[model samples]
Target: MTSHRKSLARVLAVGLAILSTGLLVAAQPGWAAPAIPAAQPVAVSAELTTADADAWLDGVLPALLEREEIPGAAVSIVRDGRVLTRRGFGLADTGISGNQPRPVDPERTIFRVGSVSKTVVATAVMQLVQRGQVDLDRPVTDYVNIELPTRFRTPITLRHLLTHTAGFEEVYANMILPAGTPVPALRETVTAAPPDQIYEPGTTPAYSNYSYALAAYVVESVTGREAAEYLQDEVLRAAGMATASFAQPLPERLNADLAQVYPSRHQQPIPFELVGPWPPGSLSASAADMAAFLLAQLNTGGSALLNQQTLALMHSPALGEDRLGGLAAGHRMALGLFEEDRNGRRILGHSGDLIHSHAALQLYPDDATGIFIAVNGSGARADSATVLRRAVLDGFADRYFPAAGPGPSPVGTAADHAQAVAGIYGLSRTPQSTFMRAYSMLASVQISADDAGTLTIPLLTDAGGTPVRLAEVEPWVWQDSEGHHRVAVRVDEAGAVGAIGVSPALVLLPKPAWQVMAAPVVAGSLGVLLFALLAWPVRAIIGWRLKAPLDLPRRDMRLRRITLTAAAVIAVGVTLWAGAVMQMSGGFSAQPGLIRGAQAATALGALGLVPAVWRAMRASRQAHKSRAVLATLVALAFLGFGAVALAGGLLLPDITY
Candidate 1:
């Protein structure tokens, strides 16, 4: 008996250990561990036309500011080895009591270049690769002596670190500790508790600052130097970015011309210390300095910083097929930069955003055109980088770089028609009840001209108050400096604002007063009903069946049959009700609205079956007999359909575009 007990104890202990191991393995985030390819040679030269490109940059600067509501911005356009245009505009600090308000001057003033610093870091890493100091494919663990959690499937590598596929959790916001806390060294942060796995390594792609932080540590370990020091010695100096430095404390030399970074909405100065993970976003420099760096990148293959082959590898996408934004097709990542084909032209670029700064640098290798923008205010949204880049490209296409002649103005008859055409229009309610909830509250304009018109429209903010001015981009299209786009308002024959048509991409709209009042109430009531029905089985099991079913078998049998019949009827009724709601919303059409309603209905219907199944099982058990599970299964099927409909209805707006 003692021997048996010992054997059982051992089995139990082993099972517990296995369970713990399984849980640990389940907790680690996924990383992409792709094999790094052999470096490919790339031709580098500084010979490209810049005349037309310079003119385009000049015209685009103001237009961009007007569209994005950016208070101040510095822009530089570079082609081949030449600087096309470098200019600045607006006030850096808008607040009255803050530092002196200054217009952005690309030549003299330094501005935080945000995540574009990643490019510099990438370049620095490549320099190490060129020198044969670091192996791109080697596990980062080989360089650093940090005890990582056992859950990571494959070891993280330099390539994974660069491409942001290092299975690290997005810990940027969380990494900002309170001012006085003992800051963990880079190694401590990398090997910190692993986050839960969203997917297996290489199967999922998520942007993570942890990867960059880890890479920074790897750089330090390999070079026996801090990340900032290595970058300055290896890349910045070689690229001729003299004003640039990764020092988080703001180097004194560049402080005099440093643009005061401001919070966009509140008009407050941004605190520098809050900019966490310096390796990714700590660098600051002037537009001219950045332009010089662009020129250097375009010119020589064997620069002191990185070889042309390594640079090419850094620019190529580490991930397959996935493109950032809709900017390009088959887009891929290089060390710190992204490479993609835009309009049949291969383009290389990086965008950066810190607490109170936004910046982007793009190079067209074929056209030898490079565009850079650095904003001192965090007024621009994250997605605005793509918009700004596209606008610059559009201006470039018009030969507006060196101030090409403006297109013919549609000022007279066409303008009037466009203005008249500009009005609020809303889509009629669909059978699926997919009409936009905010249509009645917000307004859009229809312009008299197709492309040229200047109009100011009011926009509804989050709070139910007055609308703010939004500058018109075209006759009907309006956008703010923050890249918020809207349409022109149209008046009907009755002169009343009837409906608003916003971009199909605009998911959040001003909720109407009625909708605001009704939505929560409806959602709450439905949710409660769902929960109650689902809980009925458990409640019935604990309350009545267990106690009486075994003691008074015949009576229990009768009671169980009755209970099962009642539960089935109720389930059928709920399923039918859900079906009715779905039908009212619309049939299972392919439209997003219908799909959402169907999902909701399906969820409701599926939940209705729990009680029925519990009752049937209880009855069968009490009588020691078999019964068909068909009714419960049918209820579940209906529930699934309802759920699909509901999800489709809720998410319709987001998927509409």
Candidate 2:
């Protein structure tokens, strides 16, 4: 769930983690940096030039694409409202042996821009605000046709949606569907089943595609037009992005030019991804079209799509700026963008990912420079696209605009602060109301503090793929010891860490020690249950062969059989559940029967505690020490497994994912 493929792939990832905790704890070899020599820092240039940008991209991109095994990508750099360089690399479609491959064309080949589509939607909402067609602070219910359910009285606002502060728990169901799936109206998707508002509006920043779709629905309701049409006519056309679209299954004209995304260069292309929430991540656009959008955002040559005041509002920090205390200095969420400052440059952008494709669009507002890059394949490692994009963005900033000096020094109270913040943390974007919560528990990250007070988070790494060492530079604020990434902890009144801000788009909520240990406990129970169940058959066979089964009472014997049955059922149940997760090709809803069967088996196993405990007591009273010990062990294992099932929503009435 921590990575970009946080849907079905993420469930498989967490299963691997739970089933093999040692491997996950040891290291992540997949994220290792490619064996490329580090480039020396270059002197600052007098002015941005097309020739220099072209030369730099030529030297960097081809090597990155080959090393990562990414099939193809398109990148465009915009400076002072003009495209400095736009280029494509590798084959867009890796043709069979009989046919020649089609090379990527920045001008014609379209790519799924993923979550970068959020920025486009945000721009559309701002245009409405500028024209007095929508209200930023008013409740979204005022514009939409649905009643958004929330526990808190605070109304969710358009501002909250733009900044990802609407607090909607992550929704993976129906987000991606089979290619030929019928496209639903924006209103139908948002109103069908609105996710519960898990946090108070404007309080916490949880990246939510659902919230973005709701915002788009508001756009539709206000304009009285379909979201795709409204966006195309007003936002895309205004920015001169003629080839960009928010339509699903894209128009036939654009579909012919769409790049085929692959799991990797060695694998076949995946099915055409039908994005349900089209406004959030369904935008298909060419690199040249994106370059034009950047130029319009920069308002170069007076071709601005938004007025100056509205544009500034869109780029300014709308959440987690000062509310988080010192952590506020770490990462900030600007309206529709992430405030990803680097090399002393104020960078604002959004990254988008759709299983096989990845993209990023970062704007250097201070220098009037923006670069958009999109990759067509995930490469060998599922995260290769992510790794490659980070390399380009960070490398570009360092080469063109280096930091002035070293990072801040540790504060006097660094040791105390580090000790307080060290613990297991879970992602805030997790689903709390479904069976998927079990996976979330398995995906918790442990942040450890050494004797010297430096905190280590193995999940977060540097550009070189090394675990970043962090030291508190202020109360509750930590800076990377050797890099630019910063971390900040939010504490409650009791002085315990409540949440952690790792980046503008990521927040990690603290997990109780018991909750953190649940996965391990369940795994241990499964092992014990297997051992007890296997031995039960062996003991029975031995007794039958010897014809010596006259020692125990009928009730005791019956209790023993029932207890063993529970153990066997639990083992089968757990195996089935794990297998379902690893083999999931669709949303959890797609395999309801398998999931429900496993749930029923486990629930029946939970009822074994009555007989299991009674059998243990009976054996103890009879002075049968060995039998008592084994029976007690089995009972404890059942108790542990049952506790986990109830806590993880595995037995919930509704079988929602």
Candidate 3:
């Protein structure tokens, strides 16, 4: 969900934006530079020394936890193919009193690894590829009983799935089934209501949890064991990750050791999360055990699960473009890894975010050194988890892998391009063919180019939480003032901006003007519709109370009542359903009863407008010219509102988030 969460998170951001100011995108805060990592590691008698790691943790971690209100975290450091540090800081759980807390255990406490599970799944697939039982280039349907049903004839392969280029549109609805609820078979979870194949297979990159779930399904088919069992018996056991388990609910025996994930320091811990698909994420492991896994990965040929050749293939850039999805600047997607060229050195890693838990695992395959950290949580803070994860890795890089300079400064953009990249960009992981498309507007990013050729997007804040101003460094590439982040826009042959970034957070494309402005437009349309519909009965009552003799035609009056009745139903039905959907964004059952009924009522109301319009036209032909003109205008307005609502898919039957 770390990747898919990026898309859904955009929707929540908009709600906050609407409250903060009108007509402005709020800047997302960025990770503050972490405290310095251990100075150049010195081997003093070969036992892991706490001097360097302790310096950073003592000076930085306590303040970080206090500032972000994060409860606790577990960190593991591996260097030169040996475990260097395994430590936990802060409270793992606070029994009841906010004043009392239980400390996390680095050696035994389990943390949900979230999408880090993808890497393990990738490892499993590679294991089969090594056995020649799975073909990386073959269509996925060969291994799983499912068809991509894509628009193009290009059959999606395991390579495409692992690299997230299979073109599966992300569907967040019912993605996380209840913990106590039964989990469907892996095949059923991956295949049911398959994502719409928006792009050609092996084309543009899109982050997808569904793709990884399919990867898990493939593992099950090949190994003749449930994926969790295969992962436990084969991957986890072979890698020496003794304390790890892909088992959902974590098998009660291990639950006692699981760290309690808090939504925020102030909130109570959420009960155990049960991932329905059970593939993209669900693994729980301890920091100490993860160190063993990292050591095995670093030891390539020495690894029990994979050969050096297979490991190399997994770490190389399997999917390359100008840039990669959801990765930092100058990076590309490589199988399950994000390969980045940082300061002339290459590293492969990935980050994962479950609802209450977040994790990052990265390693310099060549240097055989890396850091892994998982936080209980930083509440609803936007970039707190990122803050913790990157602090550990960035600090590690700065200390161990020093750079020559502060990297290159940004380039400049053409003066004409100032307006070329201006517009609202929606997240790429949105539903392509569902009412859920409206959710994209919530996750949109607004960009404007000034006459001075500077790009003004409230992209991210520095560690200090101040917005970072960005300007064009090279054509569509924009660099932050700190030069810490870069965003590149993809322009089509026609010179239209196709996409706005290399990373998923910045990779949104320009949305339609109407779609972007739907906030005010939809609100206004519905406001007018409700006003006119309610005025119908109000006007009739007023006229009767005034003892006025209605000289209007009975047919016209009857038509007005019929249309008003339909409009009332439309307004009420949608209002109730929308309120309910907003209140419960977590899970929307497949069959939305009242929501579907709302769709039917709205459709009938739209049809009823035809006769209403005709009557208003007839009324205009009568002597009461002023009244008739007003009626005509109201009818026309209602018709216009209905047309806009339908086109925008505001009234679609499948109202699942």
Candidate 4:
């Protein structure tokens, strides 16, 4: 047998071993797991099959339009390394009238696969790991020489970086370019600042662009090549994905059938130039090519990209207790690839999203089944992908692969109550607000009842439309499938809900609620102070001759006014910061490092003012002294703020809501 067939045989043998073990485990007394049906044979075919696949698509297409408001989409299904279906509907480019969206030709048409590029990058990184060129546990600073501001109490590892547990803030807010502004370099774009972080490294899982960008940087540092070039040569080319290419500024000649990407919500055609960080969310490929990539990974079990042992390490989830959607214990991110169990089957895959495109690739190692979908239009709902996946699974579920049995029903349904449970609930002793009105707390609950009349309370989306099911363990507390739990509501004497409590598992205890609220206020106040400080020189230049009540030089009068404004701003900032700390600390002493650092900085700046004032007084006695001193102070302040801003930009985590 050829290597491919031999590899297939070995996979089947492993599948059989796992299935037998699972059967034995299921037969144990008191183990009432759901029955998983046996796998039915599917006739292997070379040409694409549309009959059943099209039927599945038929149900999915309208649902996409109704739920996601997506005007059009394209989907493809692959079985045993073969493309079974490739179809498309609706307009690829919404701007052009009378232009019907063409069918997705698997041999042609490039669709942007967003974060899925992370998987490819992960694959490349794993390859380096396999070659002993990179260590997963090492500090990322070892790979890149840039000094990261040390707010993290614990050293950050590569695994922490990949799993998004490094406490990085979401930094993709300004990802897209507005109108005619030049697109900044990927590194520059990712490191822009303003909003800083809430916690230190490894404290929480906040999805970030910086992590992936850093991953890309690691690939470059290890391989001595740009991430795009390395991915194209190592992963794509090795997997026989010829049509795939990383997004770049130069537009390459495309095959006639390339799918046009449209802007989300607005439906404008999205140009490649607009995608800033290519490694994070900017790979273009056809559906067939995507499927081939998946097949190569599953069939070779990472051998196609790296050694067998490294592939095993990549498939092994490093997240021990940290939970990701649909992923169980022993299942987490390896490099960029996510390994998880769907129903009873072990699957390895990743999802991709750009502003105008959405794609998914799933590989079922045991059954040799692979599914890939790519959409060209913007505003494509995430539900569309889920619905399509369900349909595809349904096609194979009863006929080809049946469930063994129902697993244990998730615990308590009491917290779920009903749609009547759906609403904005208020928490007692309301905390101060950061970005919005204070004294009010809002929590949205979405309740969906299953066939058994058991209420399933899931977190509601921002739009308040759908209910995401939660995992039940206790009577009043509920956890999302991903393990983020919410506490049950208790009504008080007036028959009104008094406090909606959340369990400690969901809340970050690093800072108190009031302090959390005050941080932004402090930051904003500081910003205003800095702005006023900056305005001093401009005011001196513009209002040079203006006189005020004070018997001072006109420029000195301007300086005094600006100084008063800045001092007032700084006072507010300090007050808010101190108040927040007092409230949040709750008798718990502040970290000595953080407290001392802030105090020292403040004291230094304050002491420096003695010299500054004396210099200003002397300068004021001389002509243009006030203006020159004001200019000097403003320049110094700008430099300080710029340094803090840069450090803040680098330290902030990347998260997506």
Index of the highest-TM-score prediction = 2
Model 2 has a clash total of 1
Candidate 2 local Cα displacement, residue 201, angstroms: 1.5
lDDT of 1 at 281: 63
| Worst ten in a row by lDDT for model 2 | 22-31
lDDT of 1 by residue, 614-650 (tens): 5445554644343324333333433433343343243
Worst 10-residue stretch by lDDT in candidate 3?
A: 19-28
Question: Candidate 3 at 509: error in angstroms?
Answer: 2.7
Separately for all candidates shown, the number of backbone clashes (residues 3 or more apart, or on different chains) is 69, 1, 5, 27
How many clashes show up in model 1?
69
lDDT of 4 by residue, 464-499 (tens): 335545443343333344322233433434434322
User: How should the candidates be ordered by lDDT, best one leading?
Assistant: 2, 3, 1, 4
Model 1, residue 421: what's the lDDT?
Answer: 42
Would you estimate the TM-scores of all the predictions? 0.53, 0.91, 0.83, 0.57
**lDDT for each of the candidates?**
0.49, 0.76, 0.68, 0.48
TM-score of 3: 0.83
Question: What is candidate 3's lDDT per residue for 1-657, written digit by digit as tens?
Answer: 673336345443443342121000101123111111122332232233466776766677777777788888888888776787888888788664453567888999899888888889898998998999998889888877666668878889998888777877767666556558777778788767778888776655678888888898899987889887898889899888878997777788887788888877778887777776677778888998788888877773377778777777777656434223222223346668765334434567777777678887887787777678888875547677777666767666655665444433444554567688777777666666665554565456777777777777655455555656666655666656444545666666677877665453224667887676665654554565677777767877888999875566888778777767766766765554464455334332334665576567667767767866887888888898876876776676567657655664657655644
Residue-wise C-alpha lDDT for candidate 2, range 197-216, written one tens digit per residue: 78777767677888888999
